[model samples]
Target: MALVLPFEPNEPSIEALVALVKADMERVNATILARTGSDVAMIPEVANHLISSGGKRLRPMLTLACASLSGYRGDGHVKLAASVEFMHTATLLHDDVVDESDMRRGKLAARKLWGNEASVLVGDFLLGQAFKMMVEVGSMTCLDILATAACVIAEGEVMQLAAAKNTATSEDDYLAVIRGKTAELFAAACEVGAVLGQRPKAEQAACRSYGMNLGIAFQLVDDALDYGGSQAKLGKNVGDDFREGKITLPVLLAFRRGDASERAFWQRCLEKGEGNDADLDQAIGLMTRHRAIADTVERARHYGAIAKDALALFPNGQAKDALMEAVDFCLSRAH
Candidate 1:
C-alpha cells in the first residue's frame, strides 16, 4: 500500500513550506549562529556580514522539510540542515569574491566590506564548521553527499569562469555550469534527508531528482530575473549578469537568434566587456525581441513540471505540497 500524507490548496507562495518546517528551522537557525562563532573576531564578523544578510534560507529549509516529509524523527536533521546552510553561505562568499560583486542580500558584499582575503578565509572557516557538523551527525552517507556537492560546486565555479565572456557558450554548456554550481547542493540537501529517514533507495533517488530539477528551475528563473526583475526582489541589482559578462540562457538564446548587427552588439558588450549602463537596456531590448527571457521562463516551467512529478512517489501531504509549491515560488520570482 502507498503512504499518503495530508494536503490543502494554497496560494502560490512558500508560506506552506515555511509553516510546515517553522520549528525545525528555528533550530537550524540556532545551529547556524552557533557554528559561525570563532576565536578570531573577523571570522564571525565576515561570516555574519553575509549570513545575517536577509536572503531566504531556502536550502536549509529544504533539508528540514525533506526530513519531515520522509518521516525522520531524529534531531540529526537539524545539524544537517545547518550544515546545508553553511555550505550555501560559503559558496556565496566565495562567489561574491570571484564575481567581484558589490552587493549581496541588499548589503555590501563581504568581499567589499572586509577585503577579498578575509572573505575567502571566512568562507573556508564556515566550510570547516559545516564539515564538523556533518561529522557530528554520524551519517557517512550524508557526509559523502555534501562533500561531493562541495567539490562539484567548485568545479561549476571554474566551469563558469572558463565560459565567462565567451559568446559561443551553448545551452548544454550553460546547463553543465549551473548543474554543478547550484543544483548539486540542492540535490544533496534533499537526498541527505531521505537518507537520514532510512527511506528506500528509490525514494531517496526521487528526492534527489526533485531537488535537482527544482534547482535547475530556480537558476533558470534567476537568469531570467537578472534582466527582468527588480533589485528588491532579486536582493541584488538587476543586469548584474550582463555587467559581469555572464552568458546566461536568455543571452544565449538572444545571441543565437539575433542578426549580424545584434550579434555584433553582444560581441562588443559581452565578449569585449565594453558596455555601459545604456547597453544593459539595449540587451534587455534584444532579449525581448528574441523572446529569450520568455523562453527561459518557459524552460524553467518545463523543469518545474519535472520537479512536481518527481514527488509522485511521496503521497500528497503538507511536506509534498510545500516542496511542490517551492517550485512555483521559484518560477514566480520572475513576475
Candidate 2:
C-alpha cells in the first residue's frame, strides 16, 4: 500500500533543493539545541525526539529558501527558520494529543514518551520560545503575521473538531479548515522570509501565495495517502482516519457519489461514528466506485501546479530552482 507518486524521481534540481533543505534543517536544530540550554534537560530530550523523527521540515526550509531567493545574506534568516520549525514542532505536539495519535513518523509521539502534561507544557514552552525568537528579530511585521497565523491555526483545529464525524461537512468547510490548520503557517513562513529580506510588497504577496498553495497541496496529498498509502510508508495504520471517525476529502467525495444506502453507511460511520469493519469496507468500496481517491489526487495536483506557478515571479537561479524542486518533491512523496 505504498503511496505512489505521479512522476519519476531523477531531477537534479529537486536533488539540490533537498540537499539545501537538509543542510538548513541541521543548522536550525543546532540553534534550537543551543538556545534550549542544559537547565531544561527534558526540553532538549523532548525537542530532539520530535526533531529526530524525520519530518521534511518543509515550512522552515521554505522560510530559508524564500529568503535566499530574495537575495538575503543576513543571520536573521537562521533565527527565522528556527522559529518556523519551533512553531511547527509545537503544533505537532499539540496535534498528536488532539488526535490521540500513538505514532508519528514511525515512532512514539512526545505525549507517549512523557505524559500528556509534559507534552502540553513543552508545547507551550516551544510556542513561547518561538515568540521570543520573533521578538529578537524585532520585526513587528513578522510577529504580527505569526501571531495571526497561530490564532488561525488554533481556530482551524477547533473547526476540524466540530466537523469530525459529521457528514454535513462541505468542501468549502474542509478548505477553510485546512487553510487555517495547514496553510496559514506556511504562508507566514514565506511571508516572514520576504519580510526578513525586505522584498517588495508584491513579491511578498507572491511568496505567501506560494506557501499557501503548497500547504494545501501537501495536506491534500496527506489525506489521500491515508486511504491509498502503505502503513509502513505513512507511519500509521490503514483506515485509521475512518476508525477515528475523521471525515476527510475522500469520504466527503464518496458521500456525494453514494446512493441512499451508501449514504446511510456514511451516516452510520461518519455521522454517527459507529463504523465497524463491514462499514469501513463498504465506505472504501463506495469511494472506489466513485473514483473519489483519484479525484482527490487530481485536486492535490492542481494545487501543486498552482504552487509552482506562484514561483514564476522569481528569476531562474539555484534557490528558485530548488523551490520548484521542493514543490515537485511534495507532489512526488511516497510516504
lDDT of 1 by residue, 194-273 (tens): 99999999999999999999999999999999999888888878888898888899999999999999999999999898
Segments of candidate 1 deviating more than 4 angstroms: 1-11
Question: Can you tell me which runs of candidate 2 are displaced by over 4 Å?
Answer: 1-14, 21-23
In model 1, what lDDT does residue 18 have? 95
Taking the tens digit of each residue's C-alpha lDDT, what string does model 2 give over 1-335?
99987998584335666676676667777888776554778887887788777776778889988888888877777788888888888999899899888888888988998978777878888888899888998889999999999999999999999988777689999989999999999999998888888999988988899999989988888887887788777777778788888989999999888888888888888777788878777777788889887788778888889888988888999888888887777777633
Q: What TM-score fits each model?
A: 0.96, 0.92
Worst 10 residues of 2 by lDDT: 11-20
- Return the clash pairs for model 1, or none: none
lDDT of each: 0.92, 0.84
Error of 2 at 270 (Å): 2.5
**How many clashing pairs does model 1 include?**
0
How much lDDT does candidate 2 score? 0.84
